[model samples]
Target: MRKIPIAETLIEKMLFIFTVAGSLVIFFVIFYIFSNGLPVLKASGLSFFTTGGWDGQFTSAWTAAPGQEIWRFGAVELIAGTLLTTGGALLVAGLLGMGCAVFLAEFCPPRLRRPVEACVRLLAGIPPVIYGVVGYTTVVPLVQSLISDQLALEMVRICVLDGTSLLAGIMVLGIMITPIFVILATDALETVPLAYKAASLALGVSHWRTIVKIMIPVARRGILAGGIMAAGMAAGEFIAMAMVAGGVAFLPNPAHGLLFFLEPVRTLAANVFINSEVLGKANMESALFACASVILFICIIFSLLAQLINRPNLKGGRSR
Candidate 1:
């Protein structure tokens, strides 16, 4: 082999160092959050995860009393809200994004595909704050109006007096994550060999049947990976969610019937954001750090899931 250039060798070493540095940074962050938060979690015990209600003043009082038990720092509602919004967002994004992806991959004319795809990608580039502003101004008012009707309000037992609610958060997050699904699913679909589609068609399968049975199955791994990523993003979304989630830490009352979505809620990420300023006050900072730890755990779980789903099979090839 020819001798490598000095510049090339130096560049390779630098890249390896940078890669190692990035990984170390991630680990350092996880360690820092856990170190700061775990003691509070231990102190709170099981109640932290099982109960709902966060009174900073009460917690501060309790913190002042050294021997008194610390209670009311629970995060059950935050967890529930995070899950509800994320699940609803996934459902909405899945349906709409997959449909758009299928249409773009199979039906759109060549000339139009570029422009349409560009539009979807543009959505991914839009800042989360913009989505928050739009949701606060438009979706909130719209939800408020729709639920304000006497018959609808009575039937659903609307809990919120105005627009900011779980429904608004879900809608905003769904819209925010739709572009992720569209882009990834479109790429996955496009990667399915044309030969697969042609073979199915040659065997007397209809175009729709070919897509449903052949192309989609072959591309499902990418679609699922995209979904996992979207879920993580939805779970950790702050600004947009905070703007529309009503900023209250309370479990959605099932007694509200179909209008439970109208109830105000606060996600774990929102909890950390809303309470971030109380760094040295009571146990608030520790509690917020705990919320952050949970969020980090959730992100880690999603990442692991994506890795498992995307792992190559024993045959040394990706699953179809």
Candidate 2:
């Protein structure tokens, strides 16, 4: 046998080292965030979650001047806004995307499916900033004309409100994440065994009924995973939501029903973007990082719950 090349051995060693290092770096970053955020959590206690006030003025004896006091960071408004907008987006995206997935998987011809699937992926490639600009110029004006102007009919003043309200944010986010759900659901639907479909058909079940009852149930786990991913996209979308969510600090009322559509809203990431300059130091920035940690935690919990719900054997049904 020829002598082993030293270069090849070195390259293999380098690649292995780099991969392990990269993985450890990711873990380290996560650990650092949690460590830093713990202070805020402890300071906040239970009230941090229940109360939406973020007063950044506390007196530290070591740092306080004779008459000066300073406090920094606790942003419940941002948290609430982020959740509401993302949740609304998830609702619309999930329904429309799952519906499209069902149609594509069960009804469309293979030739039609290929192009449709390609288009769905293409939608995911569009930039969030572009979505924001479109929302501002087109979507906001339409909302103002159709809804705000109508409300103005009874009032003396006509306000051209922000197009970045909670509803607008939801619609934009829904459009953004729809592709992921559609693609994933479509893939899952395809994996559903043809035998099941045939058996249903042999039993005289309608084509639509077979798809609804048999195909969907089998692919539930994969579809649910895709849904969780879509929700993550919606939740983490900062630039787009920042532009379109009106960035109000106080929470909007869901009980106001459609009023949420008209009013401005803020999200946690949007808050970080807006108020990173608070106190002219990195204190607020660190606080924003803590907020990000919280969002990540929420996403992790949601994914866990989805996994629990979507487990194949949990329903005691056979999966093909």
Candidate 3:
């Protein structure tokens, strides 16, 4: 057996202790949530999962009117609404974000890169509430006007899709998440060794072609990693989504068909926010906790996915 240095041994023990402490903290929190949250599920049975409505009071939420305090809970609608907005945001963000990252890392002049990257990162630092406010004040009105004009031109009946809609939420969320995508993905793209770039250029490969064929493959995993991070952020986002998604706990109106994008929605995080604010409601508390538990599980899954995506790089490094 090889002798170990005393200092190195102490560091190893310290690291192990820190890891276990972190795990125990997570375990305790999860245990606490589950223990407190399961009572609602037991009382409601499968009906809680089946029905798609929220019949709780939101007296404290200034943006929403005071709703009835009747004790009732179901997450189907919330889940649907949340998924619609979050997925829509991801779709919008993914396209613009990936393209921006590619251009910033590969095509932009070296002199312009820093300022542009700084502008994108500035977005990431802004408070989520600011994004919500901006979306509500600006994007919502614009969307409403455009959609209203189109319907008027086609002689379609006027719908009350006044700014606070699934479309607005998607727009706000996508914009907020884009910075995350650009920052992480740009780092990944830059990490591709210069030798590979030089070799491809020397071999008469066009700049765009080499980037698509060589650099992309090497950095694909990291780009995906950025997407996963952005997805997690979008899913957890509440303030902006609540502001733009009309604070209704239902799917888009099916009447308009494609106009569903203009419908109001309710999300899990927003539900938690509303319900948690109302005191003296044990059942609602438990139900909201259940929603929180679900969101937590989703976050955990995204984290695991990020780790799995990075494993190929890890394995390759070890082999080499």
Task: Give the best candidate by TM-score.
Answer: 1
Q: How many residue pairs clash in each candidate at the backbone level? A: 0, 5, 0
By descending TM-score, how would the candidates be arranged?
1, 3, 2
Q: What tens digits encode model 1's per-residue C-alpha lDDT throughout 1-320? A: 99999999999999999999999999999999987788778888888888866755335644575655353367888999999999999999999999999999999999999999899999999999999999999999988886656744554443444778899999999999999988888888888888888999999999999988888888888888889988999999998988998887878888867668888888999878877777775466677788899899999999999888888772111322
Q: Give the TM-score of candidate 1.
A: 0.91
Kindly list the per-residue Cα lDDT of model 3 for residues 12-62, writing each as its tens digit: 999999999999999999888777768766766777667764643323222
lDDT per residue as tens, model 2, 1-320: 89889999999999999999999998888888777666556666665566665532211422456454222445677778878888888899888998999989878898898888888888888888998888777776766665654564542232234455777888888888999888888888888778888999999999888878898888887787787888888877888887777766666766756765776777877776666654333344456667778877877787787768667567522222
The residue pairs that clash in candidate 3, if any, are none
**What ranges in model 2 sit over 4 Å off?**
1-19, 55-69, 149-161, 278-282, 306-320
Give the higher-lDDT candidate: 1 or 2: 1
* Per-prediction TM-score to the true structure, in the order listed: 0.91, 0.82, 0.83
RMSD of each: 3.1, 4.7, 4.9
Alpha-carbon shift of residue 162 in model 3 (angstroms) = 2.0
Cα misplacement distance, residue 19 of candidate 2 (Å): 4.5
Model 3 residue 46 distance off true place after TM-score fit, in angstroms? 4.2
